[model samples]
Target: MRFFILILLFCCTFKGFSGDFSGTLNGAFTVHILLGTQEKAFNFGVSIFGTSTYKSTSVEGGININISPFFQKYGVYQGNFAGSMEFFGLIGYGKNANLLGSNVGLTRHTAFYDYTKTHNFFYGAGLVAVLNQATGNLKKFQNKQGGLILRFSDKQNSVAFNMVNDVNARPFSKSGTDKGNTARALISYTTIKNDELFGVGIGLDMFTPEADYGVAPHSHINSEEDTRLVLVNTKPYDDLFHLNLFSSFVYQNDDISFDGRFGVDNYKLGALVQNIIHDNFGLYPRFSWPVTQKGRFYSLLDFNVPFNTNFNE
Candidate 1:
């Protein structure tokens, strides 16, 4: 857990920028090894979990978390929530579900799925609810809470479903609720780095949980419609010439479609040009890299802005 946090911090642009410290929707999943001491009794294991960092509109109208498969062989599915009551963080609370896996205990006498051995991968799921209210300013550490949730797991793993929660630092802070209850299912893909190829697959969006910072300062979701789609395309001609494209859509239920994430849909497209690759200017011809029989690490670097944001929405 600590290692993951360090990686997140290292990706930051640093302080003095007045960046958002606390958020309303936040979630994630991670892997865990059983033991690394020896091959005799030790083993390697993975963990899947998620939680909503915040959910409150005015009072925070938070929705459930959205979670899917990630990384390598990791499918996280859990429902949890946390949020502030006064938007500014005068009062806040958080509730997250517990995690379970195969033979999670160190006891040799107890066996997993036998109703013993503490924990295991084949086990079911559990729940844990919490509540906290802050007294002083949000910057100052001051909060408290108390709540309850309905969670259970049996000796035999039967139920197969996962939940995930996210944070909402600012209303509409994360336009992409990849997770959470805002929408049911989503499908997004990328062919090359520094490129835009995003799409969605909706299947279970009951009453998606999205925020509206407020029209006075901001604006709520699309009033007439309740659904929306986003598409992006980026083409960099060397370092100077670059192309960018973006498109969005919204509708009632069915009868709606847009460009796919892994391919072009033809809604938007953009580009930049330089004398040379980075010379800046001109219609220089660009060539493609030949297909190689070997495949290891394939990536394109963008010295201008190496990172693109589209987290667990």
Candidate 2:
């Protein structure tokens, strides 16, 4: 991860100052301090993010890279949006055993219309390709995922909805080529004054591996689903220095074995303070409890900085 991040930073620095785009580079290094029931430590190696945008439309393309040591993630994204339609893609590497395949690499491509006049409805569709870095072949391409985004607002209230789904495929026992299909839906409501917010969502993930697919001997995929509810109150103070009280509940169920079923419940209570002294900065403190496990708590502090502020203009 450190090597990859160094390479990415070198590339960004080169392009931002020397490239023909005549753009600016912006970035920040965050300090992470976490206090939890299981452990308490401070790690400044949390994240490094940088982005650069070119000024000329004739040679228009932008790049972004993010690296996180705590999560063992490195991703680079590049896109061109000179015309009415925008095209972008991302290639990422992660060390999460459960989330990644044996190769630990993933890719995604997206092409969507960029219309500024309309705001009530929008959508994006894309394809995901997963590769095994061990072999470095173009063999594992997953299903196509599509999503719908809706936003509605008036004088008194605002509402938003987002939906996403992926086609199902048979799971791979050894390589884990196709893990499963997924579907997610979310809706949230907020007052125009931004005093309170409420949200609800559900997600389904199903995995099924057939033994006849030349896969190694392994158990079939386990199907799981989760439902979540959230509420937040931000009526304490002014915009710059305000308190947000929030809570959430989640129910999860899964079928991994033929003998029986499994289920669990989770609960969380938290608070967030936004815009301490700069734009897009905040502090989040949370406490989480599980039905059958020990409860834990943590805090997260984040800061965001934009380098090329005139890209959209």
Candidate 3:
């Protein structure tokens, strides 16, 4: 992991000093630390991030640590890649779900490469691996995934497709003999105008007797927060078929920007332990204004609601 980070830093430094380099370099660093006492127990949290970009290539690395008497968690991640004909890899480790009275530690590594000779066409492939270990045992619970992506776009319209296969196994428990193979496919289309964009997408997931789409690996890791979102869905559903449909739109101008999404799906919702599907909707809008040369003020609102009706049943 350190080697990969060093390579990325080296690339950025070399590019900045090269005589033939004509692109610009930009970077940012941020750090936050909080220490206090909650109910007579010590509590503390620390977060640090550093990012740098040269032309079309960028590098980002961050770490988050939270410690308290009742709970403790930490995570580290880094990514480096280019815009087109892209190549990047990410590795992360953190505490995940709890199983059988023991905390599960998750370590994940993801990588991908895309060939985008022209700005309108792209083809790519990606791979992901996740290792789960219990507190006091050396046993392994592993999930592996591979996927293919293709996209085509023009001035006003764009289309993209993705297909992935996932396999998971636990070799040290009573369910050691149980293994699962699942597959999923997603396709989306979008139309763009001067200041407006709209898109719709559908996804189909096929589950085996022991596998569920809710626990499948993501196509890529954009950030630590993205990975956390995926990890939150730990439930297993044996349903043979799962379908999802969604639409989204964005409208922005010099004054304000608005974006919202709505979706209906039969996939499992880990938060709602019920074994049913429903329609979900969300809306987010932001208003911003410049206060000073280097200062800006913004107000944002996010709303989400779920319907009780079983739309997919």
Candidate 4:
């Protein structure tokens, strides 16, 4: 992890010194320490996320260290309509779901062209690498996969499609018996309201049972297909207080799947308090209420405090 971080830092430093660079950095760093309830039990965790843009490049790294040691790092390089193309890389390291079995590592690399100048379409291909350490009854697994990404967006609507297949791979389940590939399609639409937006979206995700592909090997439950619908409102407020609203419906083969940290779906509301305390500090709070299912409906009230720093040439 440290080696990879150093490599990213070196890229920034080397590029800055190689040319007459003029770049600006702007973004945020958030520290989240919160306590809540789930499944009728108390829970607490802490995490930190930092995301910033340096000119045409954007980098983000985040980790959760309180309950689970989950880490994600990503970088994107945007390009103009020239010989250069947009590139992206993402890496994730963590334990599998249920905190059992073995550790898992994931890496993805993609390069695409930006066609918004002519039309609202972008197409690309990517490679995925999965590494799972031996644990429980499962053997060590290593696999290399490839996929295609197709996206289209216009003023009021957007759609994305992804299909992945294993080129050469090993079994990904603990029993070494499961296999399959995956595909997903998501479509969404939004209407402009002043500077804010209101949107509705639907997603369909499918995993063919014998797919040798190792996407999410840790959480590899026997999922035939999953679908979801969501409604969203962005920047619903015009004052110093910032707010957003979301409501979702999840349809899954598991028969008992829903949204949130817990399994209960609700009208989710979140707020941000910023700028009054300091230029780079803010607090965020979120709440949810149950609407469809009953059982011990959970209510959580936790806050996040963030501080930001930027460096540019």
Candidate 5:
């Protein structure tokens, strides 16, 4: 278990996308902190939240503020609107410089008229932080950017599928012309035998249009994009043991993206596994070597705690 935890820490330094989101709804609130370097593999977003519902209605939101190598503040919200429908939004702002700002967006979801089962589609679009490269991790979150998301999920049986798409901007990227876009898809299956007895999930994420940090006043975006795919899963062998796995697919170009071009070219396959000894508290021991890319490999101990209850659980 410690081995896989070390690999997650070592891999995070190479290059990837991460978002820490949390918020509240109605009389209760929720929080989620998601950090990942691979495309879709081994991505766990924490949710510590609460909410109150009465008179045939509901509403809620979640956000998280993370202090890391770079300053970041992000959030996500969802609830009911009109009647038999739902609404959601994602927004945030961050600055490493001596500047401050604000931003906002909206998300919506409506369910099918199936009183016994939940069948619905989801869409999200909101403002996001456009970092300026100079900003360090110690800076506070600022609301000055916009982002959007769209997703659909339905649960009637033990198997369910979810697909999500999100896009944001980076003001420092090539004079702020290059927009960063991300796409994700996840399919999850639960067992009826024990509910938590055994379960598994698969996920994917792709990053396109390489984002740039304009170092020069006249810098412009260099057209380029890198792609990644991740596979994540969780299964319980017994009442006291659980098995987890994280894998990835990556592609980029180096030589072609040189001399003012998108300098990214490579390919990689990364996988790791862990055995949970105590739910949120567990050990992961794993290893990986980037193929066709120079991404580094390292190992670090991992610690996870629920600020509230486990949303995934």
Candidate 6:
């Protein structure tokens, strides 16, 4: 992992200094001092980020290090190919247990590409691989994922579709084999008036947990007993689904410009009229006021209230 990161860093720096290079390098150091009722704490952090672009290709790399009770570090690198393809990688390591109560190390890599002829339509597919290890317990998880995206836009209308799936498993485990999978699909369409002042949009999102299998340690079971915890296979939308319809409008004059969006979902409709709000129905209005040449005040309002509770049959 260290070697890979160094290689990417070298490439980024070499490219930045190469012929006719356009790039930026940034660095920051931060110090934090906290005073509490019982104890005081002090910590510092440093980060270096850089980006380089040669014609249509670009490379970005960054690293962050924090010196606290426990040392923490993270690094990320991404490269774009001719404005149509992308490659990305990230690594993180920490000495202290994270929120999950385990010392974690993570590595991830992803690659994707988009193809378009007239610039009005696009299609792409991507692959992802990840490794997550709990250094405290020597437990590791490997995830393989893939996704597809399609988009089309014209003067008055735009449409988009996306699908993704993930499969996670325990590799080289002595206790027992465990695996789980999930998938999601989404589609959206929007159309605007000829004047481009008002627009309406609709979208649907579907997600499901495909399968799950748990592992049991040998210490928790007898030698003669099976070590598998549980197995489950579920259908799409058995977990959650959402259908949304919304409208947006923009009004502008010489002095000020105003724009906002309001939307409702099937779950929201069921909640207000039928009193059958599903766990998935939480939509909020978003509005913003920007400071214009003649105005000095700016404000914005956007919020959502999400709930997840099972209804009694």
Writing each residue's lDDT as its tens digit, candidate 3 over 83-160 gives 101112221221101000000001110101112211322122222222122121111222233345444444345565
Local lDDT at 44 for model 5: 25
Candidate 2 wrong stretches, greater than 4 Å? 1-144, 168-181, 190-212, 215-313
The residue ranges of model 4 lying beyond 4 angstroms of the native Cα positions read 1-134, 138-144, 155-158, 169-313
What TM-score does candidate 1 get on C-alpha atoms? Answer: 0.18
Scanning candidate 3 in windows of ten residues, the lowest lDDT window is 96-105
lDDT per residue (tens digit) for residues 161-280 in model 4: 333333443332332311221222333332223322233344332211232233222221111222222112122110111111222222111111112222221221110111121224
- Candidate 2, overall lDDT? 0.23
The residue-by-residue lDDT of candidate 1 on 1-313, one tens digit each, is: 2332332342232222333332222222221121111101111122211222222211111111112111211011212222222111111232211111111111111111112222212222222111121121211111211111112233222222222222233333432321122111221111111212121221111111122223122222211222222111122111111111112111111111122112121101111111132225332222111111221221111011111112333
TM-scores of all candidate predictions against the true structure: 0.18, 0.27, 0.31, 0.28, 0.29, 0.27
What number of clashing residue pairs does each candidate have, in the order they appear? Answer: 59, 0, 0, 6, 48, 0
Better of 1 and 2 by lDDT: 2
Global Cα lDDT for candidate 1: 0.19
Q: Tell me the lDDT of candidate 5.
A: 0.21
lDDT of 6 by residue, 43-85 (tens): 3434344334444443333343433321211100111110001
Identify the superior model by lDDT, candidate 2 or candidate 4: 4
lDDT of 5 at 262: 15
Best by TM-score: 3
Q: After superposition, how far is residue 299 of candidate 4 from its true place, in Å?
A: 19
Candidates 2 and 4, the one with greater TM-score: 4
Sort by lDDT, best first: 6, 3, 4, 2, 5, 1
For candidate 2, lDDT tens digit of each residue in 1-313? 2333443344255343654432222222323332322113333321122222233221111122222223211011212111011111112211111100110101111101112212222111112222112111111212333344444433333344444434334331243322222233334443211222222222222211111233232321111112222112122111111111212111111211010111111121111111121124331211111212322332222222222122223
